[model samples]
Target: MADITAPELKQRLQAGETPTIIDVRETWENEESRIDGSQNIPLGSLPDKLDELEELKDQEIIVHCKSGGRSASAKAFLTQQGFTNVRNLLGGMQGYQQS
Candidate 1:
């Protein structure tokens, strides 16, 4: 899976290149703070949510969580599941907020 830094993502967003942003964070954590327009599918629920993401398999998908750990796992899972374009947000939301 490709790794994207939070600043690069922010620049892309600012440039109006809106790739699908998937927040694999838990519901409570999502409520605390999240990037606007991101889809919240908790990490544990991702397997069941494959249908929801089917159309996005060929699109650029940027996965993120509280930190980078969960996002890395999510990226690995997506790759194993045959997702063609997946990326992990380095440092996750913490990095995004910092940027």
Candidate 2:
């Protein structure tokens, strides 16, 4: 699937669509700023979170990071692990803030 642009995501959120959103930045980065309602699961810890996220395997999941790099990796990893609808937020938080 194509990655979601920050402006597109902002519109969805404004429309009240509640897709499962994950922030793949570090704990401190997440604390500094985040999309409301997004779950914080640092990229380094995603392997350990498989069990907790198993039930959401088929659900749409949006992942973002400081500058899109980490979240892209997260999306790739999740897709490989059988998460059918994982998408990386393009440009990540930096883009989101600009949007």
Candidate 3:
């Protein structure tokens, strides 16, 4: 899976490169704060929620969680599920907030 840094992602978004951003953090985490426009799908529910992401299979998907662990797992799972353009937001939202 591809790995993208927070600054790179920010630049891409600023440049109008609107990739699908998936937030794999839990509901509580999402309630606390999240990147605008990111789709929230907690890591635990992803397997059952595959259909929700079907349309994104062929697109550039950026997965992220509180840090990077959950997103890494999500990236592997998406790859196994045949998503070719999956990527993990390196350091996740925490890194983005820091930046």
What clash count goes with each model? 0, 0, 0
- Cα lDDT, model 2, residue 21: 95
Best by lDDT: 2
lDDT of 1 by residue, 1-99 (tens): 568998999999889887899999999999999998799999999999998888888889999998999989899998888899999999999999998
Q: Note the residue pairs that clash in candidate 1.
A: none
TM-score of each: 0.95, 0.97, 0.94
Instruction: Give candidate 1 misplaced runs (Cα > 4 Å).
Output: none
Local distance difference test, per candidate?
0.91, 0.95, 0.91
User: Per-residue alpha-carbon lDDT of model 3 for 17-51, expressed as tens digits?
Assistant: 87899999999999999888898999999999999
Worst 10 residues of 3 by lDDT: 52-61
> For residues 45-78, could you state the per-residue lDDT of candidate 2 as single tens digits?
9999999999999988999999999999999999
Best by TM-score: 2
